[model samples]
Target chain A: MTTQQLTQQIRIKKSFLCIGLDVDLTKIPQHLLELEDPIFEFNKAIIDATHDLCISYKPNTAFYEAYGIKGWQSLQKTINYINEKYPEIFTIADAKRGDIGNTSTMYAKAFFQDLNFDSVTVAPYMGKDSVEPFLAFNDKHTIMLALTSNEGAFDFQTLQTNGTRGEAELSGAKELYKQVLETSKTWKNAQNLMYVVGATKAEYFTEIRKIVPDSFLLVPGVGAQGGSLSEVCKYGMNTNIGLLINSSRGIIYASNGTDFAEKAREEALKMQQEMQQILK
Target chain B: MTTQQLTQQIRIKKSFLCIGLDVDLTKIPQHLLELEDPIFEFNKAIIDATHDLCISYKPNTAFYEAYGIKGWQSLQKTINYINEKYPEIFTIADAKRGDIGNTSTMYAKAFFQDLNFDSVTVAPYMGKDSVEPFLAFNDKHTIMLALTSNEGAFDFQTLQTNGTRGEAELSGAKELYKQVLETSKTWKNAQNLMYVVGATKAEYFTEIRKIVPDSFLLVPGVGAQGGSLSEVCKYGMNTNIGLLINSSRGIIYASNGTDFAEKAREEALKMQQEMQQILK
Candidate 1:
């Protein structure tokens, strides 16, 4: 889906929250085990409970994959359910896939064509050929990884580069993540592209926004990762409310009891309420 | 699979060649199109023809992904065929997937768990958290994209990075990709870690090997992209003949006629002969 459609959805729902379906079998309610596909059963309940409150559904492909073929089947079923029932909601295959040109093209087809996800997260490490293939798809969005929240993010992302020709302007000044953001924007206008900046790294958003003021940002690490929603909204929100704050474990596995769906709804509502205040 | 196991297979087969299964629909012989699954049928024939000539089979996931559900199903069938018939042939899901820990875990499951691939390619753009999840799976290797072949690869990958506080040794010296290679090695002792250094970027291998001496290198761009196999072997080969030189189009789509498998085997045999000379 395009950023324009995503913005309209956020406005219509009065929320910027994107619930993540990183459903783990061991973590879900024991009762779901009885279902033929426990993962899908859990996701269907969660999506049904929290559909109206969120603008997007980010399904972490790993969770479904952990169960082997059953996991992939579950992922397909969950995405199909969302598409069939809540067509308005954006679906993201939270699969950070990037490869060589030919391989990237196939990946684009997998997530965009076969599975039919609105967007898929891409890693920009292999440079343009790997990422541009994903962008080649007309309607699908390619979310590039920028500054992430993890501890190891500081390892190489924040490192400063010097003596580079095209990056001489960013030589002694900005961090590598900032360079990636700026350089990536130059790749196929910021329209079909978005940046993934973690909610935990909210403070960096102000700096990130300066580089690409219009591109949407898919912000993860909110609920279960302990990133504050208020802090992220305060610094990261754009004029169009271009932020997709994802809460996976904190919402999907909100309760291991039989009332898991109700608990998920409650968790989603709390985030939506706060997003409503921020949208105002 | 670990480099040791891959090395053993290479020795047993007397070849270090990795034939890339970049099954393009348009390039496949019209005869195979009559089959129930053309891609799988084509792949099975190719594998059957070249199984004795190569130690590994690298199926660029994009080829399968482009076909969508049918593509993925074809991929499953191909891998299953290899597992059942040619179990010793190493398999690689050339899917450069990298993301935050939670999301990456799901991707690892998709390729390593469900698909049963021996190894999967990954992009290190998101740092340790993105790459670590892929490393979490035992018996599964994470091949990180280090130096790629595309024109845009020089965009950010080669940018210089100044070292931080404790990393004073890397102060104002290393490029971003170099730092990624160094830091990624520290992720899990480099046991299950491999790096993708494109054959076109053979010049960088000398320095790359210094940082990751023991790690396996998945070198693409050899055939279709015009990367020099001789130059790549000269610089990239290690004590373990640590290189998987991939020839996708040059090998698989060598001839689009009824003799496609024979032609594929012939093309792979040519590469294997050259690789043998280098190994000696």
Candidate 2:
């Protein structure tokens, strides 16, 4: 989906929330475990319960992949269900994939063409050619990691870089993530780029916004990860509501009883209600 | 498999050659296209033909992921075939995966436990928390990207970083990849760690050896990507013959006809012979 379509959905829903469909069978309701495909069933219920409360669904591939072929099957089912039922909802495959030129194209085809996700998260460690393949697909977004929410983000993302490649604007020195943002803007078909900036580092958004002000930031460290939604929205939002505040365990696993979906909706409703007020 | 077992296999086989099973449909022979599972058939042929010439088989995950479910199935079959038949052969899942702590654990499980790969490649951008989980597995190897073969490697991996976290070595400044090597060594269960250092950057291996002399380096970009065997072996090899030099298109796609497997064996044999001479 285009940014315009995503923004329209956010306006209609009154929430820029992107609910994370990161399912783990052990964490879901005990009753659901008896089902043939517990992961897909859990996701289906959560999506049905909270579709109106959020504008997007971001499924981290790791959760599905851990289950092997059955996991891939569940992922295929979940994505197909989303596209068939809620065509308006923006889907993000938070796969964190990147490789060389041709290999990356295969990945782009896997996520964008085959799976039909509107966007897929990519790691920026491999640089331009690694990312441009995803960006080449018109209107299909590529969310590259800029500053992640994990403590590991500080390991390299925030380290000061001695700028090369004619980066004179930052006075020859800046953080690695900023360099990633600036350098990425110069690549071919860069307009299709979005970024992954962790909500835990809300203060970094102000600086991040300066570099890619119009680009959507898929913020994933909220709620269970201890990132405040208000602080993230305070600095990260643009006129188009270019922030997808993601909540995974906090909302999905709110209650593991039979009313798990209803409880999830309640948790999602709380975030959406706050977002409704914030949108005003 | 443990590093000791891997080294023993390398010594016994008299080859450090690792054949990359990155199968693309269009690239394979025309006859295989008619099969029920062409990808798996193709991989099986290649593995059967060249098992003696190579110490390891590194099937890049992108090639399998591209075809979605069927592709993943092919990957499963291929890995199973290698494990069941050539139990002595070291297996590397060139997945290049990394995420937050718990999530990384899921990915580690996906490649290591579920699929039963001896080793899996991981991207080091996320730092200690992301990678330490993969290292936690016993008898399994985690190969982290150091300096990649692609041009994009120059983009972020080569950028100079102002050292923090009390890294006083190298006068408080070094390239991001070097810092990756140094920092990874400090993580828990680091003995299980290996690295991916591209053969294209043959000169960089000299410095990389200083930081990780004992750890195995999975060097790609040997033939098809224009990297020299002798150059990488000269600078990268340790007392244990610590290098798994990979060649994908150069060997596997050497012939797309009915004699494809024979041609692939011929190509692998050439590399194995060269490696044998280097061993002497």
Scoring the B chain of model 1 against the true B chain gives a TM-score of: 0.95
Candidate 1 wrongly placed segments (more than 4 Å): A163-172, B165-172
Superposition error at B123 for model 2 (Å): 0.7
lDDT tens readout by residue for model 1, A158-271:
777664734355435568788888777766645689888888877888888898888889988887777888888888888888789988888887899999999999999999
Model 2 bad stretches (over 4 Å): A165-171, B165-171
Q: Candidate 2 residues B1-280, lDDT tens each?
A: 7788888988888999999999999999999999999999999999999999899999999989999999999999999999999999999999999999999999999999999999999998888898999999978999998889999998889887776532333447788888889988989999999999999989888999999999999999998899999999989999999999999999999999999999999999999999889998
* Pairs that clash in candidate 1: A62-B106, A62-B107, A64-A71, A106-B62, A160-B161, A160-B162, A161-B160
Q: TM-scores across all candidates?
A: 0.94, 0.98
Tens-digit per-residue lDDT, B1-280, candidate 1:
5678788877777787888888888889998888899999999999999999988898887787667557778989999999899989889988777766767877887888688999998877767887888888878888888888787688778877666523455634777788888787777636788888888877888999888887888887887787998888788778888888777788888889989889999998888888777777
lDDT values of the candidates? 0.82, 0.92
DockQ score for model 2, please?
A: 0.69
Worst 10 residues of 2 chain A by lDDT: A163-172
